[model samples]
Target: MKNLKLIVFALLLTFCTTSINAQTADEIITKYIKNIGGAEKLKALKGIKMNMVTNYGGMELPVEMVQLAGGKQYVKLNMQGKEITQMASDGKTLWSTNFMTMSPEKSDAENTENALQSNADFPDAMLDYKAKGYTAEFVGKETKEGTECLKVKFTKKPIKVDGVQTDDVSYYYFETENFLPIATEIEIKAGPMKGKKSNSTMSDYQEVEGIFFPFAINMGGQDLKIKKITLNPVINEKDFAFPAIAAVTAEPAKK
Candidate 1:
């Protein structure tokens, strides 16, 4: 009789432990979506437009961004009265033109071959990371910005960028209480910046169209402060159009 009771107790404990671990990942994901407004609300956002101010190299400049469904994105920056722009759709084609550069350069064909290869970071990507050729795993819990969070690691499949092939790995710290992504650390596997690591922290989330967005972003690497960003009010569809320069270029050249 005592043996039977002990056996049942052991089985119950095992079941509870399995249940807790199973609950953690999905629960965390669901809570995060709710904090940002439910998944339904986020799906309702057809487009996003925002004005941004980025501080880098001891200078602050205004920039703009437009994001749309079907993996389309556009970014514009005004530097010394010159407008620099970059656009991409489904990651297959990209255009980046800057008055500062002697000539406009396109990303290597392999780099822009798929939506996931594009440089733009969209919030929706987090929804179904696996299906997008990304691998994610729980890396336990840690503290960030004075808040406890779950650390998740994501690795991207090999892809070419600028004619050079590379892979990327990133660590995200999601706050436990709110499920908001608080910090990110990324490592690049190839290129001039190969083996380099970058860290970014996100904060100042604001609600827009029932979704939460980080209005401020700061990225740092190798003593390089890429930018401190602050986003503005609206985004327009026309802003995401592909540039004429990109249309003229057939394929990116080999490095």
Candidate 2:
């Protein structure tokens, strides 16, 4: 009888601890969403256009990124009076400009699918994350960059890495005082940095059209400083489509 009582107590304690942890995570997320202009305002966001600059090879290059609500986006880089379409995707087809040839090339099947899946998180991933079949857990408090933050382990839909499905997990560190995400870390699944972790730090947050956005983003050791942000900017869909290279014509030979 004593053993049975102890077992029941253990089970109840486990359930209660789990419930408390889930509640804590949800509470933190709720506060974060509210602090960043609430869910309604975030959902009302249809598109975003950001003008940024990054230093590449000791030269500051102008970069423009525009993303629409339904996973349509493109990034254009200006280099020495030349416009380069680094990457563009119209939700289905993923393509990028070949720098050497200055021609558009479509990405492979695996990459395209992965890009599509990543872009599915419009506005923000934490908003309606549960509906997207994602799980969030409170991993306790941790200090990041001299600021105490609440860590949340977020697991989203599985993604294919080298033909094998792998967990798409990320750790978000939010400021405990303001409930704003300051940094995020995710393990790289492919490429030369396969086993390494990628970290993005955000700062200089400013409100734009009722929503807050980080004006300074450090991603993959590159700092992207935002000069301007336009919400719901009018855009042409053709910009995201693969470009048609003009055929060169040979001059007629004189007899």
Among these predictions, the greatest lDDT belongs to: 2
lDDT of residue 224 for candidate 1:
19
Candidate 2 per-residue lDDT, tens place, 1-255, comes to 999999999999999988887888889999999998999998988989999999999999999999998899999999998888899999889999888988889999999998899888988899999999998899999999899999999999999999999999999999988899999999999999998999999999999877889999999899999999999999998989887778899999999
lDDT of 1 by residue, 58-81 (tens): 677777666665567777777778
Which residue runs of candidate 2 sit more than 4 Å off their true CA positions?
1-4, 246-255
Q: Which window of ten consecutive residues has the lowest lDDT sum in model 1?
A: 222-231
> How much does candidate 1 score in TM-score?
0.71
Output the worst ten-in-a-row residue range by lDDT, candidate 2.
238-247
Best TM-score among the predictions, by candidate number: 2
